[model samples]
Target: MSHLLNRLTPRRGLLLIGLVSALALGGALVAQHFFGLRPCTLCHYQRIPHATLVVLGGLGGLLPLGLSTRRWLLAVGCLVALVGLGLAGWHVGVEQHWWAGTASCQAGGAQATSLADLRAQLAAGPAQPACDEITWSLFGLTMAGYNVLVFSALALLAGALAGGAPRPK
Candidate 1:
């Protein structure tokens, strides 16, 4: 473990982080397409951070950047990971009914102002899946819960890597 950490340069670490995020995103997509686990609004929202991290990681790894710039990129990645952690935690709470989801997820949107509006809304196709519903789980942990764990670890790793990297002279 120490040998691995010692060899984890910023560029390599960022690339690894990016690869992990991409894998997670791919898994989510596979779950959606192959297994027919439709994502709710919150689930879609949860994907943004991973997408951002993928871009950040790729750029940080590929670019010929100075130590300070590399550290800055990693810092940004850490922040993004924290944001993902928050989103996933919130999603888990919603799924567990600890708090209400958005209006769209509860009671199926704003009460139609009139019959015509109701019909029009109904014609717009099915309402998006409720955020509070757990569409998938493993070992009693929903995907969002697993996301919380993953993002938290990512954030800590990125932060530590960024902070520990030697400063440019």
Candidate 2:
């Protein structure tokens, strides 16, 4: 495993990170569209960092960027991953009822003063899932829990790779 990790150049590492982000987004889409799992507002918030990382990693890996630029991108990716980790951890806490969720998580009441307002609210679409609800879990861990783990690993990998000293030519 160490040998494999050693072989991953900065370019390759960035590409790998982009690919992983893409895969994670794809999986979430599959779960939402095919499996019929609705995402809450917090879940939507958690995806933002992954989307940013996808662009950062892709640009750093695919473009003719300088070494310093690549390292900078990786450092940004690390920060994004840490932000994602925080979001996911917050979501897990919401799921476990350890704390209250955001206002958007409560979709129970949509007050409408008039018929037009009621129609507009109804036409807007179905209410999103509550953040506190655990839609799926494995080994007593929800998707947010898994996200915490994934983002933690990504943060560590990106930070380490970004800070690595360049080899003497």
Candidate 3:
């Protein structure tokens, strides 16, 4: 694995990571805008790590950073990917009805206990789509399920990049 990492320079690896993150975010936007699929709370939450990776990868890949610095950035990216994985997994559980979703996941003020609370919720803008609702799916996997797979791969890739970054002479 280190041998393979040796061939791919840290700069190139970081750039690839950044590009992948950008594509993932862009795809989500396209789905929302072009397809009219409203995003739920968890869907929005899953994008945070990708956004961070875009910045980290851009800085590590494009800047005149030392090899050690690039490796550190890759390590951070690994952690961020792991965080994303957990969030996506949780979302999958919600979609599967394995567990209850967060309060904000209720799309119809289902969490309101009092008439006043319901009134306040109504006064707010339209409720977000329910996190548990599978708005889109492919092969029995929702977007969150696909995100789980992506994040897992990203975590592995970032870890490999960090470990494979050549040691400073």
Candidate 4:
């Protein structure tokens, strides 16, 4: 069983990871579109890197490849997952009111401007999803918290892939 799993084509590995990421992303989009659970700017910002990583994973599988390249690609995936972890941690902190979130959410930034600016800021749009709003939760964990747990598992998979790679002298 282990051998069969390990023998999967690199492209397939890429596809599996991409598919997982896309499913999670699509789920979030669905929640936002259908459920109207708006996301804060920071939450959105945190997603960008993971999106990039998913794309990279797909490309890595397609490019001319070998064990070393595959290892590196998986390493990149691990790093991106870690990046997600950090952003999730920050979101959790904001949710806990341990810290204020982005500038738009608060008014004490160095760039907080005049009365017009303040008025514009207020009127700019609906309150960006508050980091602490807790739009969705599962098993008593916020989305960010869930992300940390799930992505950590993926990172471990990446590390295992690296360890299983053919060693060089």
Candidate 5:
């Protein structure tokens, strides 16, 4: 374990982080498409940070950027990861009914004050899944909960990497 940790320089760590982000995104997509798990508005929002991390980490790893530039990228990645953590935390709150989700998760159709309005609302499709509802869980932890853990660790790692660490060979 010590030998493996010693071998993980900043650049290499960034590459690994990027790969993890990509895998997480891929898994989310698979859960949505293959497993038929519909994502709520917040669920969709949670994917943005991972996507950003994928781009940042990939570029930082592949491009011949200077140390300062790489550090900047890692800093940006840290910020993105923090944002993801916040979103995931909020999602967990929503799932636990500690707070309400965005209006998109609620009934979509506008309130009908008249017959025409009612008809218009009826024409619209069914309401999307509420963000407060947990579609899946493992050991009482929702995907959002897992995201909180993952992004928290990622943010810390990115922050450390951004602190002028030596680049990997």
Candidate 6:
């Protein structure tokens, strides 16, 4: 196992990150489109970093590059993923009520004169996705929790790839 991983060049490692990011993003999109699970504003915010990282990581993988470029890609790439992880973690906390979610995501915000007015305001907010209500869950895990898990795993793998110590096959 270590031997096989040790043999993967940096380009391969970056490619893996890119592919994983895309897959995760795509899966979320599918959930939203087909499963009727709409993402809240925070969820969109968390997704942006992942999407950006995927594009950058893919370019880094395919670009013929020198050592400096490789290092920069890995370092910056990890940071991007880390940002996603942080956002997802926060969203998970919000879902769990560990902290207050934005008033927009759920009810209990400042009220408008009419339901129509409140809905319109919510539609126009910074986080159009709403921070309060979760769209879906599995084993009690919200989408944000899943993102935290996946992004953290990706960050760990990226760290190992950056370390570049030859591992056993």
What TM-scores do the predictions have?
0.87, 0.92, 0.86, 0.75, 0.85, 0.80
| Residue lDDT tens for model 4, 1-169 | 3574477544556556666667667777787889988877666866675586678667766677776777778778877777877787887888788988876644233343688877876676555665667778888888777766756765666555655645431
Clashes of each: 0, 0, 0, 1, 0, 11
- Please provide the root mean square deviation of candidate 5 (C-alpha atoms, Å): 2.7
Clashing pairs in 5: none
Clashes of 4: 1
lDDT of 1 by residue, 95-149 (tens): 9989987766663566689999899998986666789878788999999998999
Which residue segments of model 5 deviate by more than 4 Å? Answer: 1-5, 107-127, 164-169
**Which residue pairs collide, candidate 2?**
none
lDDT ranking of the models: 3, 2, 1, 5, 6, 4
Query: Alpha carbon lDDT of residue 135, candidate 4?
Result: 75
Q: Give each model's whole-structure lDDT.
A: 0.85, 0.86, 0.86, 0.68, 0.85, 0.77
* Highest-scoring model, lDDT: 3
- Residue 127 of candidate 1: its Cα lDDT? 65
- TM-score for model 3? 0.86
In TM-score terms, candidate 2 sits at 0.92
lDDT string, candidate 2, 46-155, tens digits: 89988988898899889988888888888999999999999999999999899999888886546789999889889887778889989898899888998899889888
- On TM-score, who's better, 3 or 4? 3
The candidate that wins on TM-score is: 2
Error of 5 at 100 (Å): 1.4
| Predicted candidate 6 versus true structure: per-residue lDDT over 43-81, tens digit per residue | 778889779878877887888876567656877778888
